[model samples]
Target: METIFGLDLPTWWFLVVGGVFTGYAILDGFDLGAGALHLFFKKEESRRIALNAIGPVWDGNEVWLVIGGGALFAGFPVVYATVFSAFYELFMLFLVLLIFRAISIEFRSKEPMAWWRQLWDVSYSVSSIMLALSLGLVLGNIIQGLPIDDQFIYRGTVGDFFNPFSILMAITTLSLFMMHGAIYLVMKTENRLYAKLTVLVKNTTIFFVLMFALSTVYTLLYLPHMVERFKEVPMMFFFPVLTILAVANITRQITKRKYRFAFFSSAFVTAMLMALVAVGLFPNIVLSTIDPQFHIDIHNGSSTDKSLKIMLTFAVIGVPLVGLYTGFVFWTFRGKVKLDETSY
Candidate 1:
């Protein structure tokens, strides 16, 4: 492949999106996972502990969302606009849920009143569930494709958003996050709560495994055309298999009370799964059933050569700065969370 400005445009866009989304998953994955665990915390102190585990870093973790969204808008505006318009109602509902959850996280501990704190705790957990579900549904719908007219616009309604594949994806996302959160708690906390998290992981790992298997089967069933491709490229199976091994390692380590390595292993598993999906779906940024031409191939959906070249130049200068800032924040907040009576 010929390169422009030391990089191919379409490949660069794919890399950008893949990098941004992976960052979002690893960073915000814990935030959502922690929030999902809110209802599990029975005592006020426990709830505060859960909240504090994510407190110092949650806000910064959310910056990945902004970066991911901004990258999509700038790098692939058409895809962004089309998908957003297609799922306008669903997107709005998702945003509202996310906002409520974000607000509740900050405002929930403002008072010592049992009712007020409990109410926000409920909101946080519910909102986290909805957010994860919505994100999974969006992925499912995109992978499944939608009706579009000659104008290259989506011609689907809100009801079309909840198909079997999409729902399966929602469950997969929910399960994945729950497991991810549990791994995080193991890493960051000790005492009864940590032991409880270990027990929770033991209890939930089977369900996570089952849900993953079901989602894989459902996706393969729905998208049978890709089966042949996978068959031809047998090496592609390595990532999924590695993910399984990683999960197994995480379980084994947790059983041995190796919290630190367990968390890192879980994160590695997620990254491998993501890489597998990206490689599996290469060349086709968006698949379409209505017409193959309707599919948004990376080559076709990319910006002009001039635009990409210019963007490449800016990326070279700016991406390093983003990396530096992200690193600094993570380093500054590297310790386990401590929730005192007066701490926020």
Candidate 2:
């Protein structure tokens, strides 16, 4: 009930939640995007080249996800429990896809057999699609609000979890990630692979643009409360506008085959869009449709000031180090990928 330093715990909860997801988008966005774009590489060597571009960083990129889960469990236990409980099936399915994709990324490259690699390629691409969709669905569910009972418990049925609004959100997320991956592939690969990616990104951009339009409609119609929240805040609206501009720029650049700039714009758009969502969900972490009293703010869901203080100290010390390590890895491996034709 008390404020921490200045702001309440709920505010900090939102900060951490938003920070983690935004960071993940910037880090894993390209990685997963590359996986989604993996289908564009028809030749085995081309595909392998794309994989190598991200091979060293993909696993580390996943650490943000772990950090997000850990933060939710420790800082916002209420939100974590309610969301997972209500979407048990979805979460389980998401886990399976994530694990399968990770494994396939490594194992697919180990074997030279055509069928073997094809199977893993399908697994990797499909898993990326599902992961992106599930992420969008989760965001939709949050924005649309959830069914909570008197005891502050979730009352969602299996079928209820996948409403039309959530499904549209899933499509939007998937399309955005696909575009993100396409741009990244174009940025990192060279030769025919890069040439092929320019065409792939052009095609993918159309789908993402369509999805963005549809998602706008869905948000306005189905999540009026969320729309209202954004409308009431003038500054907050800029992020989405900037995101749209960035997406448009990405498309324009990809048309001209400006690979690096398009990738940068795509990543920028993803980051900005995530920030917009986090801003939209501010003050209220979990909105209850049944009763306003059932709503959970960050403070109600967070640990004590002492725990936060300790972790904040550690986070301050460790975050920059993680950033440095990430930078070093990318810098060390910075260049176009070239796969061994003899190997898988």
Candidate 2 residue-wise lDDT, 1-344, digit = tens: 55777976557656776777777877887777778877867887788888887887888888888878877777777788888888889899989998999899879967768999999999998898888888888888888789987676888788876888889888888788888877777777777877787778888888889998888876777666666667787877788889889988987887777778887887788788777676666677888989878887776666777777666666666666777887899898787775665433
* All candidates: TM-score: 0.93, 0.92
Q: Pick the candidate with the highest lDDT.
A: 2
C-alpha displacement of 212 in model 1, angstroms? 0.6
Name the weakest run of 10 consecutive residues (lDDT summed) in model 2: 335-344
Candidate 1 C-alpha lDDT tens digits along 214-260: 98887677776545556778877777788889988977887787777
- What are the clashing pairs of model 1? none
Best by TM-score: 1
